[model samples]
Target: MTSDADPRFLRSREAILNAARELLLESGPTAVTHVQVAERAGVGRATVYRHWPQAEPLLVEAMATVPMPFLDKPTVPTREWLRRELTAIARQLDLDDVRAVSTTLANTALWDEDMDARRAQFAGILTTRLAAALDDAQARGEITLALASQDAAAMTIGPMYYRSTIERAPADPALIDAAVNALGTWAAG
Candidate 1:
């Protein structure tokens, strides 16, 4: 259905969305009004409001653009792979865009049904990737065959989220190592 929209119309809409995302990352939701988006997008306010009657939908869409990569297999030892993945997460969290977008998403209460669904969808994609990484580790004799892929995926993300959000601590690589080791998070199944 969306694909049936006019090419020019769709392009304009994308410009508005991109503008909104930039504003959000630069100054939070309050600063990203439709008028501001229109100005940044080089379009009219009516166009922005026509597409997004409210800013919440725009905010959610903008947030969907935030980049989040999943695990890349390390040479051997699953711990090493976990180390690299977690370290990369920590590094990404350091970016302003990541912080702005993630802060909005991490505060669960702020999510509407659409935002929640989008967030879940992205999480599912990441989990699938995590599953692949876990499968690889298991194949390489680093992870145990008995471990559930979904559980392993959760194990990989949950702590990093906790450290970055509630704990108000950096998701340092060393901290990741310690936390996983302490939990025995992925211990032989």
Candidate 2:
């Protein structure tokens, strides 16, 4: 049995995830069977199964590798910070392959509780970060609305997600800018 401490074992596990991601994108989640991933990765079925007992978790791990924008430690207020954060998110979401993978995971996660939790956890991370930015913005008088920080964060992010998942459209920079500007306008009211 390959232990977690084994470097070769770690490489095999990464290979499995990479293969699974590529297959998931090419053929969707239903086609990402252990044997298929193993063959694509040039590893054994046992190795793939040993690392990821279930396909959902395997895909969740693969989706986790999708790059999110890196936010700097906020020394500034929320509205300004949120603008920067959203700009970064917009750029990341503009990548066609990244958008496809995200949409696939979102579709799969709806029916799978494990995948749902993974998606929720990922969203929570961004929410918390955005909330902090919002709070700082409020303190600096950058926002005058009485909305909760979390709600404000959601308002800023929800549209992008809606367009990407529901509309199945690429995130347009102009649209993102308009959304961010609209949020700023609402908060200033």
Candidate 3:
């Protein structure tokens, strides 16, 4: 039987994926070529090719493995929940792989359909969680729903992104706290 049917095949595939993920997380998509993944996984290039026809699939898989942040409907006070979400943003920004690739993804949407799709998916997740928090705030008479929930959500995340991408700074807890306070004050108005 081909390796696909064997239990060992799963191990091999896992090794390949882990190797690709490590490289992608260290550098970016450009570092995750078939030859490199095969070398890192101790597999043959042809084997890598057989499993994944192109680098893009491997890149996608590797990126998919990176844990995206999720915040449930919170039980804590609004400010605390906002702090948690802001902290999540700060943590995500600390990922070298994400920072390396975000600029290209942000600017090259027309040419990079793959990245564009990824961005859309990420943004959708972000908007959903943010909107939920805003909904809670509105219910509590905390915020003006004068703007679209998504737009307000953008306002919440935009500063964190600015610090991550433009300011070239690390995730500071104090900064997250400040952001949370600003968001809370705005919502309270």
Q: Highest lDDT among the candidates is held by which one?
A: 3
CA shift at 60, candidate 3, in angstroms?
4.8
| Stretches of model 3 off by over 4 angstroms after superposition | 1-42, 45-60, 65-67, 142-146, 184-189
TM-score of each: 0.62, 0.61, 0.62
Cα RMSD, model 3? 6.2
User: What's model 1's lDDT at 186?
Assistant: 53
lDDT of each: 0.69, 0.69, 0.72
Q: After the best TM-score superposition of candidate 2, give how far the Cα of residue 125 lies from its true spot, in angstroms.
A: 0.9
Q: Positional deviation of 72 in candidate 1, in angstroms?
A: 5.6
Candidate 1 regions with alpha-carbon error over 4 angstroms: 1-12, 18-40, 44-60, 63-68, 72-78, 95-97, 106-111, 145-147, 179-189
Q: Taking the tens digit of each residue's C-alpha lDDT, what string does model 2 give over 123-174?
A: 8777787677666666667765556667755676777767766776766767
What shift in Å separates residue 126 of candidate 1 from its native position after superposition?
1.8
Clashes of each: 0, 3, 0
On lDDT, the stronger of 1 and 3 is 3
Which digits, one per residue and each the tens of the lDDT, describe model 1 over residues 1-189?
A: 245378978998999989988887787556677889999999999889888886656776886786544564345566666677777777666654455556665454255676677778777777777777667766666656455776765676677776766676677666777645642345553
Indicate the residue-level lDDT of 76 in model 1.
56
